[model samples]
Target: MTNVVIVGAGPTGLTLACGLARQGVAVRVLERATAHADGSRGKTLNPRSLEIFADLGLAGELAAVGRTHLPFRKYFEGVFVNETEPFAGARRSATIPYPASRWLQQPQLEALLRERLAALGVTVELGADLVDVRQDADGAEAVLADGRRIAAGYLVGCDGGRSTVRKLLGIPFVGEGDPEPVMVCGDVEVEGLDPGAWHQWFGPQGAFMLCPFEGSPRWQLQASPETAADGTMVPPSLESFQRLADTHTGREDIRLGNATWLSTWRVNVRMAERYREGRVLLAGDCAHVHPTAGGLGMNTGIQDSWNLAWKLGHVVRGLAGPALLDTYQEERLPIAAWTLDVTSAGMAAVVKGIDTPGIGVEVGGVGDFTGLSLGYRWSSLAAGTPAGGDPGALLRAGDRAPDGPCPGPDGAPGRLFERFAGDDFTLLVLGAGTRPDLAGLPGHVRPVRVEDRDGEVRRAYGVTGEALVLVRPDNHIALVTPATEPGPVHAYLARLGATG
Candidate 1:
């Protein structure tokens, strides 16, 4: 029997397999496609998402191949309205190890993840689409397209929006489609222009976005034509793609060459009513799908994998209770909802030619929306979170703390995220006065103090005001109280099956 059977070999499934395999858990990822998924769906990596990859030891590779999308621009009717770079303070505040946000192609990003999983000896079965699934108290079983049966301690569906596992499990995905789907995406080589920077053209012709792909001057184009309804139904042919480009840019001489991958898809803003059922769980597109405006789809899926991987591994290893898995849905579902909201609003603003939506901010790191700086508010562990205020406050016990750099007890420069290296629990202490005596806590719980030697790390966590923030192995905040006694800390761990 396998420890975990993941249905889908996209970034989410591959990432989960990589994380679990690093923790010595046997993971099998099944994909319906005959080979790795190579598409041009999402092209940008939010700063926080890049930090997650850094913890997985792929930051160097990601940084090497990925392009930093500087000078973000907004155009109105083919006219430039405003342009700005990434948050400046974010680059300066890195007591953490990774940069804020960078842009990389989806194919390269997925390839790197698959390579890491392979290096760890995790095998992904391509073309083995999940046809049927069933779960019991002991384990879950999946039927592949070839009529093969695989049993595992748990099964997670990371397949795309049309998820067979999700359908077989009878989970209702509650959401709606974009009434005006104004996004068309495909990868093509431009013959006459240097694809070194990101360019956007807006106006009566709608909006066109082009970004440079790695190792070539070729560009990936995403746009909405004024004549086309919702950027959907454009034929996936070279002639069709060039025609759309011509209509948007009004350049008849532009030839779209090297038509490697092409597809026209509609954007949906939907998520599952619930993310898990018994021994079965959901991640990636299976759990939620949002507009591709903010490039949040793939990143959110990767985050879901990060959230579920550690607990699943621990439960399978008999180190944590099955109840620990409940936190996955509780913690991630909110993010999916919030991301959808942000993307929906932003897309509406962009389409209407609005220069500054509430989501846009200056370069000083005031409003970051990669879901990296977001905190948890609605969990049993986060009982003290302020009610009804802006939910994006500092990290609480049940929220994932933003990662930055910190000095270890050994005085070595360490990242707050490095604690999640290969998956382990972390306890973040704010004030020296409130550092609970953790001598009696479980050995796996890593206690960290953000008391002195910095202001950004201190302010970023809001621990000075709130006291202590307990972070889970998956990086979700587990608790937040104003310098409480050790009782709540001990109680929190016990509830999650942590033993001293």
Candidate 2:
């Protein structure tokens, strides 16, 4: 009976629920677990994710808890080698406000999102296991394990790598894992180690790492996965961790105990063949998974939810056609593909060179791990994107919209992000010469006339005088055309069925 029934309560599901609930969409988030997930899953939040969280009004909260300048200290046989700051020389301009990444535990991020969802009048329904998903042309029904059926206009699967909804839907998750387990990971208390830096010890055998969590006594311990003679990965334990430390670091005095969230990780890289299946769709790990090296899993999933939330909200609210839902896959599926390739290569590099294996910028195979360069230029929703370039403009349609200084509603100076905030399409009419053909636009479109104050707005967007840029609710550019020729804007809205 709700507009959306989101499966799983991880960061992806919670973000979707928050976006929809904020837009007055009746949303229900069902989680199979009885409580929030624990462990230091995907501790790094990239710059693009910071921008999303900022839009969600979590910038201050995340900054308060996030460590932006954690340095990676390396060692060889427990002997200090060299240290490196991952985000050294990162730039921060008006366009890239959150230029650096932050390290915060996954559970803490989930808690913040859950708090935001509660503020929007929606709570995650835990202890609810989905057994089946059925959908017709009109709506979808989630069949719970306890014989409860929750019907909604649409359903999204945001579950983890082993997604039940995806399996039930028969969507093929095509990819492979390493021949054996790649690493053993857990959160444990380490004695005789500095909790200030990410301590790593590399040897001829393999590499062992223990990253200290902010304001916590426990550290995330990762080491080469132990295999039995029969070739089965040995389960993680404090004793196993101690053995790894002793073998790699020759540190017999250091003790490890109070282990939690123990598990073995593999260099598994897989993605759903498709993101959408009829009225049901998948996001986050439900759609794709990456290797444990770069911590790109949760960030990719959260961005997937961000991309889908607004489109699904529009369709459910009768503001756009069902075809709009197809763009979700068109846009995010390619991103998943890119993430898998880069992260897989990065993991391989890490395994091949353990003595001085690279991290962050050194490891990303093709692009940066910050998730800033991701886009969907091929999406059908990205209308009016020309084949050629404007020498003066650096951005095209479907690019992540950069933030910059501009005039507010009352002609007061403000940033573009303030206008882009909320669940609405921001139509930015820049400069005095731009045309004002705002009639028949959808009610969700918020048109703002900016003076381009001090040329900051134009510089960030890389646009010239008299330009109209339509930004999507997820803060991606939908269309960019000259103000003199505004037909593209109207035509694009017409294609989206957004005309009033």
Candidate 3:
């Protein structure tokens, strides 16, 4: 029997498989398609997603493929409007290591993750047509189209918007959907166009844009879909896209060649009522789907898997009971709800700014889109702030732990994220070297004592006095307690079934 049977080999499934595989949990990633998908679906990896890749040890390969510093040049009827680099001000700092967003096609990112998962001793099984699913308190069973049954401790669905696992589970996907398709996108070879910047043309006909990828002949094509007399969207094609480019730019010099892939997107702001049902759970587009305006679709799913992995790993390893799995839904459901609302508003803003020539309108850059501001302050695991902890503290329980300069175990210069990376719950003892007696603590809950020599970590963490910040494996602040008190620390661990 496998520890977990994950349906869908997309980024979310693959990432979860890698996380569990790192902990020696048997994970099977099954994909319905015979091969991996190649598309221009999601192209932006926000700062938070970049941090996740860093933790997975794929930072070097990911950075090499993602392009940053490309300015978006706008055109109105073939006239130069202006140029705005979205991430120009996102500079690296001690607190924020990956401040800039990286632009790469979804296929490229998935390819990198697949390679990493393989290194971790797992491969995605192709053509896995999961037809049915049944679960109980003990475990879940998956039935494939070939009349084969695979039993596992848990099942997860990451199989895109139209998910089979979710359907089999009869989960309600409640949200607002568009009556017709909204946008048409494609990947195509371009001619006579500058690849230095993302060239966009806006007109009364609608919006048209071509974003070039570094070291690739293909560019991502985006345009407002044309509606037919029946009020349905006309499917995207090479010739149809050419017409859109000509109509929007009012120029015939530009040409689109060899449309490799094409797809249409409808306005979908939806979420599963619950992420977990007994031994089965849902994530990624299978759990929630929002507007692509903020480029949060793929990033949110990547984060969802990251958050669920550590919890699921704990349960599979017997370190924590199944109650820990409940937290996965509790924490992620709220985040997904927030994503749907924010992305919907962001999409409305994009439509409102379609006729404007100024670049002041924020599309997918800045603010919460970077994902640094997101936290689980309301999570049961975070356990709320300490009894006497400041309610208005800058860094509170359930917040995404910030990065800052710190000393490593060898007393060498290093960063806090470097210590937080991997499959361990880090108990960061801040202010002074007041390391707690971790003798009876779970092996995964390791302690890190860092003296605030230059006050870098102190300032980033917003801690003025001696404090113990318990960071979860996914790098969220589990709790913050006064360093003088070790009872709360021990009690919290016991709550997590980590008593030694």
Candidate 3 local lDDT, 318-390, one digit each (tens): 8887789888888889889888888888887778677777542356332388888998888888766742566
Off by over 4 Å in 3: 227-233, 359-361, 364-367, 386-388, 433-435
Which ranges of candidate 2 are over 4 A from the true structure? 227-233, 355-366, 386-393, 433-435
Q: Is candidate 1 or candidate 2 better by TM-score?
A: 2
Clashes (candidate 1): 18
Candidate 1 lDDT over 1-500, as tens digits, reads: 99899998888888889889988998898888898656666777876677778879997899798666555554554445666666445553554444556777787888898889889987678789778998898999998879899999889898889899889989998988855545566777886544554666655655566667767655777766334467455555667667766665566565778776665557688889899899999999999887666667788898888878888888887778888788788888988888878777766655555333222222212234566567556665465552222346644545556667666778787777776565777767665455566777788787777654555666766544435566776666666555556567777778778776
Evaluate model 3: give its TM-score.
0.96
Q: How many clashing residue pairs are found in candidate 3?
A: 0
- How big is the positional error of residue 195 in model 2, measured in Å on the Cα after superposition? 1.7
Model 2 lDDT tens row, 43-101: 88889988998998999899888588778888776677778886788888887888888
* Residue 485, model 1, lDDT: 60
Which pairs clash (backbone N, Cα, C closer than 3 Å) in model 2? none
Models 1 onward score TM values of 0.86, 0.95, 0.96
